[model samples]
Target chain A: MTSTLKIGDVTFSKIPRVLIAKPGLDGHDRGAKYVAKALRDAGMEVIYTGIRQTPEDIAAAAVQEDVDIVGLSLLSGAHNELFPRVVQALKSRGGADIPVFGGGIIPDADFADLKRAGICAIFTPGARIDDIVREIHGILES
Target chain B: MLVRRSLDLNSLASQISGDTVLEGVEPWASRVRALSKALSLLENDPWLATRFLQHPALAKLSTNARVVGLTGLPGAGKSTLTNLIVGRLRKLGKSVAVLAVDPSSTDTGGAVLGDRIRMQDHFCDPQVYIRSMGSRGALGGVSRATRGAIRLIGLLGYDYILVETVGIGQSESEIVSIADTTTLVLMPNSGDDIQLMKAGVLQMADVYVVNKCDLSNPQRMLSELRANSEARGRGNEWTPPVLATSAAEQQGLDEFVDALQKHAEYEHDHPEGRAIKRKRVQTEIATNLLFILEREVQKMVAQVPDAEVNAVQAGQLPAMVVANRLFTEAFAMVQQGKIEKNST
Candidate 1:
């Protein structure tokens, strides 16, 4: 499977590491686990942080892990309270500019609001696994 | 079913101390490397899917993750938008999971398999979980197993689960079945604006995004959106805001986040709406599960004694009569087991 993907004359077989964390009190993990497997299949490193984390803790972990991308899975309807705190914490920790993306039961009305709060991208459930891998590849390569 | 030693949920939660693996055995930084290695192995392995489903790691996540869904049309720039949003969300100190679904080829019955190729920006990031699913001719343009996978992600304790679909179409309607919110992505120039209004996509719009604002005719598109909104008289109540974004340029992302936050507040204020939505979700799940179980049971019963089936077919007894007899027999067995347990 790794041999199937080559870019610019490079095999590009290494899997990228992504830290998938749960923040606050949201409790939904099936999507996250399936995605983790999908990414792994795509040949990327995946660090899954167990649920109920604060923005500060997540940022610190991202820093410690030296991760290039961070993802939040917010489903408890706390994107408003949690997203900003995560962004602020990341910035304060000198980890600003790291790409942050989120998706979960987020209403269509709230998608824009989340982006404005510093979320780089938003994905709803209808998203394909290939598209996600493509986005992660594009973000890391860029 | 193999029953492993069960760890009490309360005990695990209290004793685990931290979600992170016990320190020292694997340094947090190095653990990222190990995780990457594991992912690579899984990606290259043909049996990856089976092993993943059987992994013990999942048992720990009884509750602690959020699964999200994103659906749109082929050219809706879903890949681009996912990159833009996931990037920002990660920087904000959140671990993200993305399940981007792709359409299967009409000819080969296989997926085009290009999503991972297109999204390269977060390729090496240790914080993002990105995966793709082949529709494989599933109705609604998503895999049926995708729901079970979403449940697994939630149980594993991910903070956010993002499911991005191929794009807006009748098939995209499945997002409503599995996602808390479904985002409909559209381009202004598609000339389907009015169609979108009529097709119920506009009604599904919690946040309507018009991508490619940098184009010369973005405002023209916005005007059309405004006109359409006014025509519907949707502004008097909560108006779904239209945002112009250029995923390629990484523009208007902040405004997008803001809109999501505001809507979250709105949902909180209206519990009735939330309740209605949750009930629908629960019913959908129950209906699917029951349907599958019933089908399997019927199949199994068909192989039972032909004498019993023939007895009913002879018209001497009604079909319902035979069904009732079998049901009662099964019920009696269950009752007998319960009685024995109580006696013990």
Candidate 2:
């Protein structure tokens, strides 16, 4: 784990950059802030787009920051509308291959719909920090 | 199973150089996409990044964009001011790009770039492009990839480029060389006057902004800034103007915009000011060239005999002597036209 993580055949010389954004009008940033800290502690560069960011803002930041992964955290029950828009925007902005994941108050019922919309994975409330980190490694390594 | 697609460097370069295009997307529609891809390539692949930057096509695509560097201490409302400035410039129908550099963690070389949060209102605007860059262990508060990003944005036809450095003080003189006008933002009652003078921060400001004017004691801070500026004795004719603004309240932004316009005009009119700009550009070019040369030298050093390094490590030879020998070998390699071939 101390060695650089490889996404594919290419080995990165620098640390992986992860863009963690809060989409929609969700005022709660405790979750996003915690995850950002976790990723930083995991030896990844994390760019946290502050609260209430539109899908466009998140996508644009993803491309401009050149991040390896985009993590969306939402608590306002607008995940269905906002998360897909972000994935679409990232595709349009030449980041179609970048992995997208989420963690928030997303319902268990919406997991399939979110996955269909191109979300790779989702973490519910009370998820372990080590599990989230392991999920990231598994996703990137795949 | 998840599929992972690797980056295609050749295709990315072709798109950036306009030699190829994705079908169904118009040339203009693909420009931003291509630029984004090129920037990512620049960050990931050093050898390709060097080749892409030194491409002859870049020289042909010249732009007259003005690059403004905004810097201050943390929580000085730089992002707020930047958002206001972007709004003003967009109102005037000018295309703007903002490159916000955030500090990297020294231990992990990671950063949480959150500057885009304050400026998210402009996210949907096609005329405004905002980017957050990590300082990436750069001492000057700006990322090395930023120069390439600026050049790419300029080529994409941006009229103004605003570079917001990690709230840095004093020794970050690299901003002065990178920016056409370097603005130092200060907050009221911050007790920054002594630090400002000690760090030679006063000399770096082409425009001093007292942001959060609605807060306590802005006038006092403004007067202190003015006094310090006057005492420094400028090497040029233009005196940096101290302007006040409350970005949160949206007051004094008009006057701040006017001051920027006037500064631009002054630089255009004065030969001395233009000479200073030229010198800055020269310094930037020299610095980048040295960086490239250093990489080449490192490559040559890697090929040196391990016995030599072991001798130095064992204290059998002075480290400086081994370094000198490596430099001499690197110099010989450079003379043999081997350096040019090393750009893979």
Candidate 3:
């Protein structure tokens, strides 16, 4: 009774691949590393680009990885500088439809700003790890 | 077609799982080029990602390097600014890596990968490494796997890493997630500039620069920026400082660098800020993972027979009964695999 159906080519996958990268120079990657581990444990494919990536590089990798979700981890205080660039590059590269989400030391008030700029969710500090994984699933499934 | 293959995937998995050091560091120059090629292949080949998901380096990369995002409106001179920042950081005796996000090649699913070509001065300089990425159909305007590339850069021992976004309005904001800080660049008197302002530019700004300051009406635009900031008030403990610069002339950059240094120092001193940053990371990971798991479960359940579904629908059986049965079967499959591993 339970063996005859299939969901897409893969079974109940919430983005099988993740492209994780840093956008600019602030040289702190502890947060990104932790998140990669969390995502990997959750059974999603995680490609963690350690540090110092351009938005183009990140976007290119995301496209190459055929990732369902694009997760950017910024601690350089330069998210404002890098987010839009990656977004635009992705859009230009025809990846404007892939779900893009991110987290970092963004200020509280800037949360809405990041969203309006096109990020699905901006998880500031204090956001639960479970919440992050959940949001990735939510964004992809939706 | 996607069933377990003959090759020992488990062996490959075990190879990249722990602290086993991967060799071939010295040929990083060519290795990075190959890495880029492999990554592109993974993007086009779904099986590639599935196969490499177990690679230890893919997930176990370090976090010691700086992650920066360089953003500005089109023609706001981000390329010039990137050159300047990289140049300055180099003069300060820091090794730099630039992750440039560019448009993709439609035919091959690859990027032109041309940012390095533009920054030719640093090409011969071993202190700098530049890599370009294509967005490749990601929503919210950036690629999904940007962090992975950044991690690789850090692992290579670069002191400072820079990310330059493809500057499009609104959608460009995904950079906030990957950068420690973001600098928003603008120019005086562009028609669409007002549109961006009204679209909530103030909040996306960690540092605001009125680029092309050498152009006319710089003061008036600066005043407008100030007015906007004043209206918003000093909302956070760290007030985003506004500066004027001409990326073409390379003027006012030292002050910008100083301001960036000051903000970096402030973040270091403020334990609250650090805590907040950590919290953001935790939330992103947890939320995305759960989302994926639930989706997988749903897919698994969809494989259930229609009669079983109808039985639940008709109230002959509880929905939980169906769900539990499915989960149990799935877990059993997993358990069986684990047992097989132990036996092997």
* Candidate number of the best lDDT: 2
- Residue B19 of model 1, lDDT score: 47
Which digits, one per residue and each the tens of the lDDT, describe model 2 over residues B30-120?
5666777667656556555666655554545777899999988888999989998999999999999999998877777666777988887
Q: Report the C-alpha lDDT of model 2 over A1-142, residue by residue, as the tens digit.
A: 2122212233234457789989988889998899898877776778887888888788877876677789999998999999999999887776787899999999999999999999999998999989998899678777
TM-score of chain A taken by itself, candidate 1 = 0.84
- Give candidate 1 misplaced runs (Cα > 4 Å): A1-142, B1-66, B105-109, B200-202, B223-238, B297-344
Per-residue CA lDDT of candidate 1, range A89-141, in tens?
Answer: 66654456467888677788987778888888777789887898788767777
- For all predictions, the C-alpha RMSD in Å is 17.3, 5.2, 19.0
Best by DockQ: 2
Over B1-344, each residue of candidate 3 has an lDDT whose tens digit, in order, gives: 01111222233222223223124322333334334433443334433443344344444544577777777676687767877888888888988888777554343333333344356456446567765566666643346556555654565578877888776565567776677777877787644336546654446666778889887668777777776666553544666677899877889898777767776776677775586568657755774465446657777877999999899889999999888888788789877784332111
When summed lDDT is taken over every stretch of 10 residues in candidate 2 chain B, the lowest stretch is B1-10
Q: What's the DockQ for every one of the candidates?
A: 0.02, 0.27, 0.02
CA error at residue B78 for candidate 2, angstroms: 1.2
Candidate 1 lDDT tens digits, B260-305: 6566555556665477467757977685667445654585487667
**TM-score for candidate 1:** 0.52
The list of candidate 2 runs beyond 4 A from truth reads A1-14, B1-5, B17-29, B55-59, B192-196, B231-236, B300-322, B325-344
Model 3, position B31, has a per-residue lDDT of 37
Q: lDDT scores for all predictions?
A: 0.60, 0.79, 0.63
Clashing pairs in model 2, backbone N/Cα/C closer than 3 A = none
